[model samples]
Target: MENPFGAQTDSESGSAKSYALMTARGPQNCIESLHHPRPRAATRAGRSGVQSDYGSSKNLETKTPNSCPRKPTRFLTALSWQYPNEGVIKINTDGCRKGEDGHITARGVLRDSSGQWMRGFAVNLGIGQVLEVELWGIYLGLKIAWDIGCSSAVVLESDSATAVHLLNKNVEHFHPLATMLWGCQDYINKNWVCSIHHVYRECNMVADKVAELSSCLELGLSTFQDPSDSIRSFLSEGLLGVCRP
Candidate 1:
């Protein structure tokens, strides 16, 4: 099958495209084949520049392509998960949808300032859009943080840029995932400090692996007080500041 994440595949030879790996010293052109499954299509909020409930509203109605500023050029950078500030907790969340059966799942991991795992959760959301599933992961992560009495503050990180952008902008009331967005807003509006950010997929491997685990487990939500054996290596890499391409 063709790679879903837009990696060019050789039909005749069955070889995948190679990506350049970057390191602290410099860019090392290592030929390594990687395959990424295709994700669901984005909703209306992702297609247009609308204001989100969490941030200041922007008048996109009067804006045109020429009026909008050009996006910054993105460079290849090594990424690693960073520890949160003192007295703050960091939550990394990711959503995964299997290309074979379209099974959607969301997972989150909460770590302390010292990079110790506090709590984690995985939910099998059955069938849903990618944005909705990503939001569900954020909502559940915040709920878990609140339930554990995270009094200081919390920083949530997601690999899906669309999901992060949607949270910062206003979703239309008629959007299919409007209610789901509202649920996430309720957690953000609580009397506590919580911020959401977009991280590269490399920095979110732990949550990504956890989300993929839902394929074998029972449907519903599962919480973990201790790090599972499968994800312990990834968690250790985060603490060691290991960078990935």
Candidate 2:
């Protein structure tokens, strides 16, 4: 077959061919690819110095390219539970709050340089914000450590970075929990080798489990000298293996 506008076409053949000749554009005879045949008006626009409203001929090579979406890179950290230095006891604390009507519970577990659970405490804060519970956990953890002769050195760890920042005097804010902050600050000031840091929640599993258990108790504080079967499992899981990405 042939186009009436000085171009040829072969549609019934195994491959199709289409062409256009424009005398105004210096005998420009644009040939369309077998897959994409250019419309006659678009070919005429080329002669009138009009850019192709459609993409260029090169873009018609493939309607869709053969490319796979990239997968996101995975970041892995070998961070796991670690013991404190000699004469220093590491205290891991966590807090849990369920809902507006639920109770706020804070729990802390103290471990020696040998990773021995020296003492653990769980306080039922009745109902409070998560941040307040975390701060209370710190205050109680430090006080218990002091009472139990962990005074040589203390390394407090919490999952909540906000609470750790406040405890370490990294930032200051005035809230109802300011009293607990004052207590933590006073203890840190008096202790010569006291330090607080933020640890991944996986490394603080024992404290997290204890905190969840505190919410089940009947609105009171409880202390554990010998960890229960559940708490023991959480501590073992945290210390036994490296976290995989």
Candidate 3:
């Protein structure tokens, strides 16, 4: 009868019998255990194979909490746009995107401490991601600022938090906008004092208006020595007293 549990066959039995007879001089204890495998010791981990006993670690349970994580609540505080300090200029930049697949536009306006527009630019980037356009606005705005000889204590403000975060880190990354960001950093290093900041979209109306111009204009890039009547009016309106929370 065939053994389902695989009892030794006749040939195997004959071989073992011969081998045992040849090794009759060997210890009886060693020879007895060779035919039957020993059962493994039971573990506290049960059938789930034990790695190391978790109970042995004193700090393991304390390190990991049993409760589920909760989301943090964020509140928005109203902010009013303001001008820079004495002998300083504030460059406000914004990027406009219609949608994920739509066109992108970058625009920026540089204003003196008195909120007078010194220079502004609008570039139609055709189509791109929002971050790319945001960084581009900073990059091109810095270049224009440098060209116009406003190198001292320039404060750049952008509504894009992502762009400000990257600028503040001052590190190179594998991001697609890394080149432009590095270029902006290079400008910052050359300047006496350059700082990038983040602001709410409502507080950045002047830059937003310039960015809106990029979407409507047919030009790839337009540098304004003097802003148009509409843009001039917009900047004049924004120069009013700062709104409070």
Indicate which candidate wins on TM-score.
1
| lDDT winner | 1
| Cα lDDT of model 2 by residue, 1-245, tens digit | 22111212222222111111211221111111112221121111112111111111111122233353454443344456776667778888899988768567778889888788787776555655778778778877877777767767777788888776555442333344555565566566554467677777766778887777554453444566677776776667655654522
| Model 1 lDDT tens row, 82-161 | 87789889888999888765677788899999999887776665655677679878877888788778966777888777
The alpha-carbon root-mean-square deviation between model 3 and the true structure, to one decimal in Å, is 32.9
TM-score of each: 0.69, 0.66, 0.64
Higher-ranked by lDDT: 2 or 3: 3
lDDT of each: 0.65, 0.59, 0.61
Instruction: Estimate, for each residue in 157-204, the C-alpha lDDT of model 3 and write its tens digit.
Output: 888887776765535444545555665666666635776677777678
Q: TM-score for model 1?
A: 0.69
Q: What is the lDDT, from 0 to 100, of the residue 222 in candidate 2?
A: 55
Taking the candidates one at a time, how many backbone clashes does each contain?
Answer: 4, 0, 0
Q: Could you report the Cα RMSD, in angstroms, for every candidate shown?
A: 16.9, 35.5, 32.9
- Candidate 2 error regions (>4 Å): 1-73, 170-174, 241-245
In terms of lDDT, the poorest run of 10 residues in model 2 is 48-57
